[model samples]
Target: MDSRVVNKGQLPELLDKLARDHTLIAPVREEENVTLFKKVSGASEVQLDYITSDVSPKGCIFPQTEKTISYTYTGDTLEMKEQDEPPKTVLFGVRPCDINSILALDPVFEGKFLDTYYLEKRKNTVIIGLSCSTILSTCFCTAFNSGPCDGKGADLMFTELGDKYYVEVNTEKGSSLVEAYSQYFSKGDTDKLAKAKEEQAKKLEGQFRRKVDLEGVKQVLDENFELPYWDKVFKKCLGCGICTYVCPTCHCFDIFDYVTGEFTGDRFRCWDSCMFPDFTLMAGGHNPRPSRKERVRNRFMHKLKYHLDRYNLDGCVGCGRCISKCPVNIDITQIIKDLKEVGQNA
Candidate 1:
């Protein structure tokens, strides 16, 4: 990856230039106390200091309600309309955790049946990730072999230093963008850039107050299915499902059709949380994991164990949205720390 430095106070103009060539989407605080990744006409709207947002950036690509196709019933024949164009855009200011979740989700969406909707949007977009300097008590990216500096899913990465930003071009698309937008940047200076990067790296690599013991986390969680800690830990859970809805890595969802009067609209899928008792309810009036303890157990187990078995990677990126968002104040890092089998910090 080629690295360079952009001059101070020019990010907005650079974003405008990028928006001219591509659809730029960055974090914008729309309403009071809400941040969303939306189309950026200019960089002035981007909120770089925001650590966590109410809505996950995943919704930008995987919309809450997407019309797969339109169909109208005509007694004899039916007409169906399929999408003609693919989505072309750029997702910028992505955090390392959110970016890794996108990559982790690649196998799920593109693994067996190619989710044309997701793939089309993915293929057309470029991810520009930024190093995380702010971390909440719940952040545990280190557990998943990721950090603020991990560039796993980003085509381009940005690290803040003083008032300027250090850019790393990770892919050919990113390299070309840097080359194309050379006017906004200055020649790279190795010494200052190195010192700046080291400063950023130090915060990402060492500032975290909390992290998980991940080596045997999967194995320990797998073998401790019968652990009695679940009941005690989730005793206060109201099961409102807000945690998963805000989580960037929690991807469980359900698809169903909505009918109005004589006809049905397109099939739709919305974010679903495992914390809900009805989330796993089976047919014939039976639910295997019916208790709150089970629901709580499943959330952690899926993040630390099931995802590793299914995707060869841990499901959690530890963005801390779940921690700050949970109404009951249940913290996952505290749960992991209390786990009997997961080795304690040295």
Candidate 2:
């Protein structure tokens, strides 16, 4: 757990070095109100002051659309080709909640059935997490025992401590990268800077305006699978799927083939959402989740109970992108609070 200090002025040079060595992905402001994680060449392309990107950087690992294999068949001959290996990558400026989301996803891709597509990118990438300095109205990471500065799953964590960046090397991958670029880091006793980061985390915790409690909410969802609560929430849902798209933990996808010619095609996988009606449709055209009520119930149930039941980890990380992006103002925190109230009444 060695820590080092780097002047804010040297960040550009550090980014330049990393970009030259690996594929660099960081947050960049596309417009006044929009910030998205994109491939960057240096610090000039990175938005270092953003609270959160509009979209999670999860796409870097499990892409929205990916070609799994290409195939061609002519007469009696057939040929198939798999995709290339992912390049060495540096995922920079990830928030702690997003880091937690990646951990939540790890089991889904790594258990009895391993997803090599995701595993390859994960194996070749180095995660450089950034500590959150400010709190948004929707943020409630504290409810999950995660804070703005928690670096639980990161290889390296960078906290902006006034004029300098306090870098904590948490893994061998991080240590090797730091050792390789020793010129950017300054030798120092990082105790004072680490303390400052803690103080910053505490201050930001109190600044959170939302109080999200999950004490008995999961139990309620587990007991009452068919509730009048589904009727209330689903009425307002537009089935837009924005929540799943912005969510860091939602990982449903569909696979099919795209025909290129008479004897050629490529098999691809793309993101799918349980919020959509077709998500549960069978090949016979019978949909288990036939209405918005069932779909909406399933979505929240998956978040509150199912994922935790399967993975022993909280499915929702309280990042609040779903809350902020929902056109009808459907909030997961509000849902948890309401569910707790429902449980108390029952």
Q: Weakest 10 consecutive residues, lDDT, candidate 1?
A: 337-346
- Give model 2's TM-score versus the native structure: 0.98
Residue pairs in candidate 2 whose N, alpha carbon or C atoms collide under 3 angstroms: none
TM-score of each candidate structure, all chains considered together: 0.91, 0.98
lDDT of 2 by residue, 22-53 (tens): 99999999966688888898889999889978
For all candidates, what are the clash counts?
A: 0, 0
Top model number, TM-score: 2
**Residue-level lDDT tens digits of model 1 in 1-346:** 5777887688888888888788889988976769878888878888888776667788777776676776667777766776656656888999888998887777778877898888888888889888877776677787777887777778888888878788877898777777788887666684688677877777667778885665555566766688767778779888888887888777777787665437535656777788887888988879988898899888888877888899887688788888888899988777776773544431
Note the Cα lDDT for every prediction shown. Answer: 0.78, 0.93
Instruction: Highest lDDT: give the candidate number.
Output: 2
